[model samples]
Target: MIKNMKWLLLVSLTFVACNNDDSDTPAEVPVVAGSAVFTKYIALGDSFAAGYSDGALFAKGQSNSYANILSQQFAAAGGGAFTTPLMLDNIGGFSSGGLQVPKFPTRLTFIGATSSPANVPGVSATPITTHLTGTFSNLGVPGAKSFHLIAPGYGNLAGVFATPATANPYFARFASSATTSVLADAVAQTPTFFSLFIGGNDVLGYATNGGVPTSQDPVLGDDITPTATFNFAYNTLVTTLTANGAKGVVANLPYITTLPHFTTVPYNPLTAKSIGKNNDAVGLATIKLLNAQLYGPLKQALTALGAGDRINLLSETSTSPLLIKDETLPNLGAQLAAIFAPTLGAQTAGAYGAIFGQARQAKTTDLILLTTKDAIGTAPTAANSGLGIAPAFPLNAFGISFPLQDKHVLIPTEIAEIKTATDAYNVIIAAAAEAKGLAFVDTRSVLAQLSNGGFRFGNFTMTSSYAVGGAFSLDGVHPSARGYGLIANIFIDAINAKYGSTLRHVDLALYPIQYPLTIQ
Candidate 1:
């Protein structure tokens, strides 16, 4: 009986070993057959995907984005040419060390223009001018919102680069007001593979507004992409792409506040010391509270201020008062002075305006704030200075930026809020990508790392410091072409890893910055 029991135990062990061996046997996992399944690639998204920046949409920036770069690799592997909204012309090249970039039109502000609207050319038209030849593959649109992709006949809509009514001579030669947009065109194309990068511009408009509570000011209009809307549009877009038998990649939004434009101009809280009032003058806090109303949650706080606090709020934007020009803030500081003066008396108001002007003119400690830091540079004094106002930095010169305008202090709360919103947006992006089986590229972290020092990309060092051969543009918000390339690589690596594609990596050495050769 003992002998039979030992034999039974040995047989049971042998059976278990055999089962383990079978489980360990290599299974025939299917490889993605025919790279051509991904051959007919279509790209859809906003400016980052389109590589729009530096005030002009151009081929160089457009071609360098990861989508285009990936498409190039796909084509080399027998894919098709990527179709994009290539800028028609007047794209200014990079500045030294890539620190200063000339805005579109070189001189005109987004707010200020001449009596006659300047003619600006548009992207290519269909057939002869457009991408209908079936040779085209990329479909990137600048200023495109997530839902805009599906909007009826959006491509043919005017006011993108030019308006048809203006008979805008500039666009007459190049505008394709009749051409189909990325959404309609890509859907019509029926690509086997696609890339979707939309919804960035949605939140961007609000962040640019300084994070004011849209709930209180309906006129302010909610600038962020409503979460529900984003979900609906994004789901529909993805469903359509997948249902069409196309496999594609999607990217999340980049942090808005990280750009050089936002970072370079900081508002220092301490400089509030330079501004104060006595029994004769209104308190500086009133000026501050009022100015803060134009942005952020401070408007609620301003409403609570007493009439005795009637002194004009010194704006952190211009270091003067908030002014409205026909309901819109004008490009000039004089406009703010005119509208914001307390009804003390004509003399007092004039005196206030003069003092406001002095603050506007003050370089040592007068603070200026704007709906955008971009406006700060255009302040009359800095415009006349020949040398633009230096961006404010933290006193420690470490990474933390303390907002300042010509040494004057500005509030830190709104800026901090902007950064917080950016972080939150990026987090949403990351979570969404993970849930949807997509790759999330943390551009904020990547940029911060580079700016804090620099990052290594295939032996190349990419820094974020302005014009220091770093990756940022002059506005400090947008990246240099090289910077964009770095961005492309970040997305590319993520896509490659998630999808198992061995696409060629970006060649950073080929792209060079044009501004501040050294940070010091």
Candidate 2:
């Protein structure tokens, strides 16, 4: 917290220093009568910028996306309309804050809680998830990796849009089946100012898998997109954006683990039966180290297996090892490592036992190794029970419930890795924007401020409160509508500063976050 304060102070100093007494305002871009006027804007990226959350996509949520909000201001400043594929849902009402909701249900415990895990009253039956199509100004696909944007038939990917059926309800509304992906559609539009927010999902998939480097196919290797692929796609995306006389901004990925989503559910050692609560914090630290070690070895094993073989392994284990079939687990570590270098076995199994021990003390038991069946379904017919991670309940043994606090913060080493990746991505973005002479907004710092320092939105002062506050949705990572609007202002400020555009800032007063202060 002190470090953040120091950083904020530095930023304030820089801002003051940069804006000396000389107040020579720059000239604005001349406007004419509806001349397809630009700054022609196009937005491309993943979910956060896409505005995906809260059971529906509507005017408020759509308008909250930085891209859409910026486009509105840009249009007002003589830019063109920023068209995005809209995803809408029907209206519904529900009651929350009741006794039955069951207090926040730890972390992984929510797996079998219900489809609508919010624990609010009534059934949530509106179309919750959706996809985009046609000429969408917002190319931010919810689960898209950098490469997924250009992948053929990406619209059909089950993971991209969450719903019971294969096709997204929103996509089903407008698109029968898209011939071209959203990226291609945007490129064909010949935009003048394009914004790219891609590459987040690239590392996100790996992180979500608990940093497992495993893949789906036995023939294909390393399911996660490598650092190389991320760079290449980012460069190509920028190249295409600039090819059509478009000049614009691109955002770099955030340290995913820092967000409340990953950090909430404190690692309580007592829960795992390794240590008392007094030593929980220390144990948590140890677990983080072990996770990095495990992730490194997993990556090496995948690389040796080759792409085809790796993909097969991935099919068996994506998020939890329990999902993998027993037959598949036997083939998992060896066949791939054998193809690459069987010597990799040295890093397997008890490779980081000490670290695991420490983590055990900390209560982060997601790493505890149980047989695939034990992890997946109920207590292996009771013959093999009372083992694996503590609190080995009948439900968890059956894979019916998710483990609480299963996720954790990025350890120092992991944080370093993330920073390196973020730095590389940011440098490329900075260079591209500089080359095109476009406004390069530093969104990372702005996000850090919001996440750390509470920001005011009219009557309500929205703050990032781990899991409780309305600022962030249930996921604890993504922002609520008001949170996104706060972000939109950062983009708006950059546009105003660079292009001498005087677009109106969003009215914080209009959208007040609901924070009812109840007397306990």
Instruction: Find the candidate with the highest TM-score and give its number.
Output: 2
Clashes per candidate, residues 3 or more apart or on different chains:
39, 29
lDDT of 2 at 498: 66
Model 1 lDDT-worst window of ten: 393-402
Estimate the lDDT of model 1.
0.48
lDDT tens digits by residue: candidate 1, 221-290: 3356566666666776777766766666666665555555445443432223323322213334533543
In candidate 2 the C-alpha lDDT for residue 513 amounts to 40
Model 2 TM-score, all chains together: 0.58
lDDT of 2 at 57: 40
Per-candidate TM equals 0.57, 0.58
